[model samples]
Each structure stands twice: as structure tokens, then as C-alpha cells.
Target: MRSLFTIGLIASWYASNIGVLLLNKFLLSNYGFKYPIFLTLCHMMACSLLSYIAIEWLKIAPMQRVKSRLQMMKISALGFIFCLSVVGGNISLRYLPVSFNQAVGATTPFFTAVFAVVMTSKREGWITYVTLVPVVAGVIIASGGEPLFHLFGFMMCIGATAARALKSVLQGLLLSSEGEKLNSMNLLMYMAPVAVMALFPAALYMERGVVGITIALARDDWKFLIYLLFNSALAYFVNLANFLVTKHTSPLTLQVLGNAKGAVAVVISILIFKNPVSITGMLGYSLTVAGVILYTEAKKRSM
Candidate 1:
């Protein structure tokens, strides 16, 4: 039964993740929504509200009070990183093909490895280190042959990827070090609101006097607003599933599953967007996906 629940949670996480990716691409690229930061702010707002209801009203997860000022600060710091990572990803979608974006985003494990080594002085087995090579190499190869590659988009995606990795590492360290820790639902109840607060200023500044334009566009097309609301709701589920998965399974499993999700997302993006992929790009992406699988297996063996 536990295994079944884990599988269900993983499935939900992957589905919601892919759904949001495609939906966001549709909005930002196809539908011509020009404000990534604002969209992210909307997502955070939705998540904040949903998390509150889940924790406070629905009683999904017991609320745990923060034991100290230090812990609250740590979670707030995480919220800041979360805002940046998400906004960066949404912005990159505006300028890059989802195929290339997922390919680049798959490099999160590589960044995770680097951060683990640098921050925690954690050493991995040789095979663990070896598996990351193809991950990085593949992205470099794909970048060289990408038809839709924009330098700015590539940078933003990479930044988002690294920030995500950093968050994973930091969250582990922060939560573990504390005597009392909030579970994922409770943590998000706090983090989501902070993330919304952190992102609003940036969205306002970045969107820059375009509120009238966005409001006009939304009024003209109620469907777009519907899509945005659905997208944000899916984002909330993604967060819930992410925490549940990590709680039920090991982080290593989540890491491996994430790579698989990215691969699936790339294929779906290609089919939906009819994006052209070069021979070199396909080979690179294939290699990267295979490498991530191998890395997952290697980690399993080491464990």
C-alpha cells in the first residue's frame, strides 16, 4: 500500500509538472503572454492560498510552529530562492523552445553534485562522478546546434536550474539541522506567501507599466485567464506532489524521476510545438537522458 501510494504521488508530480510546462509554454510563447514574473507571482499567490486551506482548513498536514527565528529566516531564504528559480524558468520559456529548455534543465543533478561537494564536502563514489559527465556534455552539444537558442534564454534556464539545485541542498541542510522541522505542506504554507511577496516587486518592475495591456488582453480573452488559473492550480499540485514524493521515497528517487519527467516533457513539447531538432541535438539529448538514468542506477548501487 505504501509503495502504491508512492507510485501515485510520483505519477501526480510528473503529470502536473509536464502539464504546467506545456501550459506555461503555450501561454508565454504561443499565446503571447509577455510577463513571466507576473505569471509566477500569480502562481505563488495561488499556491499560497491553496496551501493555507490545505493546512489550516483541510488538515492535510499538521502545522508545526517554527522553533526559532533562525528557522523562519531559513525558510524565508528558501522562499527567495524559490521565487527566482520559478521566475527564471517562466522567463526562459518565453524565449526558448521547451525541448531545449528541458534539455538544459536536466543539468540540475550536475549542479546538485557540485553544490553537495562544495558546500557539504560530501564525496561520492567514482561512478557517481563519472555519470555527471554526459549530463553536462550533452547540454553543451545541444546548445551548439539548437535552432531556437537565445543566449539570454539559455542563461536564465541555466540559472534557474542551478538555483533549483541549490534549493534542494539548502532545504535538506536547513530542515535537518533544526530540532523541529515543518513538513512540506506546512513549509509551503509559509514559503508560498513569502515567495509571492518577494516576486511582486520584481514582476511589477519587470512588467513596467504594462498592467493595462495585460488587463485588456485578459478581458478580451477570458480563455487565457482560465488557462492561467488552471496552470497555477497545477503548480500547487506539483509542489504538493514534490514534497510527498520526497517524503515517501528517497531524494535520489525523486532526482532520477525528475530526469525522466524532463525527457517526457521534451518529447511532448516537440510533438505539440512542432519544434525542429537537429541530429546533434537529438543525440545530445538522448545521451543526457541515458546518463541521468545511469547516474540514478549508480547512486542506487552505492547506497
Candidate 2:
């Protein structure tokens, strides 16, 4: 029963992630939503509002109050990083195919390992470190052959991936030692609002005139509004599902699920977008994914 529950969580995470990514791509790439930052702000807003209702009204989890100035600062810092990571990801989608983006994102485990070692002085065996080689090499190979590679988009994707990895490492380090370490749902409740605050000015400045355009577009097509709402709604589910998955299973299982998710997302994007991928790109992504699986297995064995 526990295994079945874990499988369900994994399936939910996969479905939510894939659905959200495809929707965002369709909105940004096909539907001509040019302001990725603004779109990201919308996502954050939805997350914040839902998180508040979930914690405060629905009582899904006890509301965790901000206990200390220091803790607030810490979470705020995390929120800022989260904004960068998510905004960067959305921006990348504007210039890159979803397939290539997911391919590049496959390198996140490498960044996670590096940050874990640097942040916590944790040591991994040489075999563990060596596994990262193929993960990185595969991405580079795929990048070189990416049919629609944009330099700016590639850089943003890499930055987003690294920031994501750093968030995981820092959250573990900082939150573990806190007197009151909030669970994932409460953590999202606090982080989502701060992330919105961090993103607002940037969205306002960078997306000047975009608001009116989007509003006009939405007015013409009510479906645009629906897509935006659905996109943001899925974002919330992604966070909720991730938290539930972690609660039900070990982090190792989540990591392994992530490896599969990346590959599946890439394939789905290729099919949906009809993006042309080179043979070299396919081989490269395969190596990266295989490396990620090896890394996960190695870590699990070590544990």
C-alpha cells in the first residue's frame, strides 16, 4: 500500500510538471505571451494566494508564524533565490524549445552535489563525483546540437537549474538547524509571498506595457485567461505534490523520480512541439539521464 501510494505521488508529480510545462510553452511560445517575467509573477501570485488559503482557511497545515527576525531574513533570502530560479526558467522557455530546456535541466543533480559539498562540507566518494561527468557532458553535447538554441535562453536555463540546486542545498542546511523548521506546505506559504514581493518590481520594470497587451489579448480570447489560470493552478499543484511525495517517501525516491521526469518531459515536448532534435542530442540526453540514475542509485546505496 505504501509503495502504491508512493507510485501515485510520483505519477501526480510527473503529470503536474509535464502539464504545466507544456501549458507555459504554449502560452509563451505559441500564444505570443512575450513577458515571461510577468507570467512568472502571475504564477507566484497564484501560489501565494492558494498557500494562504490552504494554511489559514482550509487548515491543511497549522499556520507557522514567523518566529524571529533572523528566521524571516533567512526565508526571505530563500524567496529571492526562488524568484530568480523560476523567473529564469520561464524566460528561457521563450527562446528555447521545451525539449532542449529539459535536456539542460538534467544537469541539476550535478549542481546539487557541488552545492551540497561546498555548503555542508559533506564528502562523497570518487565514484559519486565521477558520475557527474556524463551528466554535464551530455548536456553540452545536446546544447551543441540543439536546433533552436539561443545563447540567452541557454544561459538563463543553466542559471535557473543551478539556483534550483542551490535552493535545495541551502534549505536543508538552514532549515534543519532552525528551532522551528516548517514542513514543505508551510514553507511554501511563507516563501511564495516573499517571492512575489521580490519579483514585483522586476516584472513592473521589465514588463513595461506588457500588462495592457496581455489584458487586451485576454479580452479578445477568454481562453487566454483560462490558460493562464490553469497554468498557475498547476504550479500550485506541483508544489503541493512535491511536498506530499517527500513526506511519503525518501528524498532518494524523489530524486530518482526527477531523473525520470526530466527525460519524459523532454520526450513529451518533442512530440508536442514537433521540435527536431539531432541524433547527437538524443544520445547526449540519454547519457545525462543515465548518469543521473547512476548517481541516484549510488547515493541510495551509500545511504
Candidate 3:
């Protein structure tokens, strides 16, 4: 029964994660909603509201309070990084096929390892370091063979991936102390509103007239509102499911699941979007995923 529950949580995480990606791609790429910043803002807003309800009112997770001004500053910094990652991801989806985007995103472990070394001066074993070679090489191969490749989209996706890894490193650095540590749910509870605040001015500056455009679009199609709402809700669920999965299982299991999730997402995306994938592209993606799995195993053994 416990194993069944874990399976359900994993399934939910996959669904929420992939669902949000597809919905974001559809809204930005096909549905004519081109404002990635605004879309990300809506997601943060939903996360902020839902996290509060889940932690405070519903008692789904214990409430955690920001203990100090310095802690608040750290969380704000994380929120800024989170905004960059999410908005960049959404923008990329407009220009890149979902499969290609996921392909680029699969290099995140490589970035994370690099950041850990550069930022913290932590060194991994030679075997672990060597594993990253194929991770980088595979992306290079995929880029050359991607039929729908957009240079701008590739850059944005890479930037988002690096920012994501940086966030993980920074979180460990900034919140490693027992007093400062907050579980994922509580962290989201605080971080989401900060992200919304950080995103608002940028959205206004970068996506001028988006508000009016979204409103007009919604007026023409009431279902647009539904799409936004559902997408935003899934955004929150993605984080929730991730935290739950990690809590119920081990972090190693989560890492393994995440690697598989990227592959599954790529296949589902290709099927749904009807994106053309060259044989080289698929081989490159396979190599990258294989490298990630090897990296995970190497890290596990080192630990």
C-alpha cells in the first residue's frame, strides 16, 4: 500500500510537470499568448496563494515562518533566480519544440556539478566528472540535428538550466543551517510571493501591453481563463508533488525519477506536438539521459 502511494505520487508529479510544460507551450506557441513573463507571473501568483492555503489553513504542511531579515534576503534571492528560470523556460517554449527544450534541460546535472565546484570548491570523483562529458557532448549533437532549432530558444533554455542549478547550489549555501532550513513546501510558501513581486516590474517593462492583450484574448475566448488557471494550478502541483515524492522516497530515488521524467516528457511531447525528431536527435537525447543516469549512480556510489 505504501508502495502504491509512492507510485501515485510519482505519477502525479509526472503529470503535473508534463502537463504544465505542454500547456505553457500551447499557450505561448500555438494559442497565440506570447507573453511569457505574464504567464509566469500567473503561475507564481497561483503558487503563492495555494501554498499559503496548504500550509496555513489546511495544515497540509506545517507552517514555517521567516525567522530573520537575512533569511528573507536569501529567499528573495532564490525567488529572483526562480523567476529567471521559469520565465526563460516559458519564453523558450515559444520558439523551441518541447522535445528540444527538454533535451537542453537534461544538462542540468552537469551545470549543478559545475556550479558546486565553482561556487563551493567541492570536487567530485574523476569518474563522476568524466560522466558529464557525454552530457555536454550529447546536447551539442542534438543541437546540430534539431530540425526546429532556434538559436535564441536554445540560449534561453540553457540559461534557464544554469540558473536552476545555481539556485540549488545557492540554496544549500544560504540555507544549510538548521535554523534556516525550510522544507520544500514551506520554502515555496515564502518564495512564491517573492517571485511574484520580483516578476511584476520585469513583466511590466519587458512585456508592455501584455495585460491588455491577455484581457482581450480572454474576452474573445473564455476558455483562455481556464487554461491560465489550470496551468497555474498545475505549476503549484508540480512543486507539491516533487516535495511529497522526495519526502516519501529518498533524494536518490527522486533524482532517478527526475532523469526518467525528462525522457518520458520528451516522448510524450513529440507525440503530442508532432515535432520532427531526427535519428541523431534521438540518439543524442538517449546519450544524454544515459550520462545522467551514470552520473547519478556515480554520485550515489561516492556518497
**What TM-score would candidate 1 get against the native?**
0.93
Off by over 4 Å in 2: 1-7
Relative to the true structure, candidate 3 has a C-alpha RMSD (angstroms) of: 0.8
RMSD of 1: 1.9
> By TM-score, highest first, what's the ranking?
3, 2, 1
Estimate every model's Cα lDDT from 0 to 1: 0.88, 0.88, 0.93
Query: Which one is best on TM-score?
Result: 3
Clashes per candidate (backbone, < 3 Å): 0, 0, 0
Score candidate 2 by TM-score against the native.
0.95
**Residue 10, candidate 1: how far off, in angstroms?**
4.0
Report the lDDT tens digits of candidate 2 across residue range 1-303.
878988888899999999999998999888888888888888999999998898899887788888889888888878888888999899999999998899888898899998988889998888888888999999989988888889999999999999999998888877776575888888888888998887788888988988888889889999999999999989998998898888888777788788888889988899899988999888988999998888887777787
Model 2 Cα displacement at 72 (Å)?
0.5
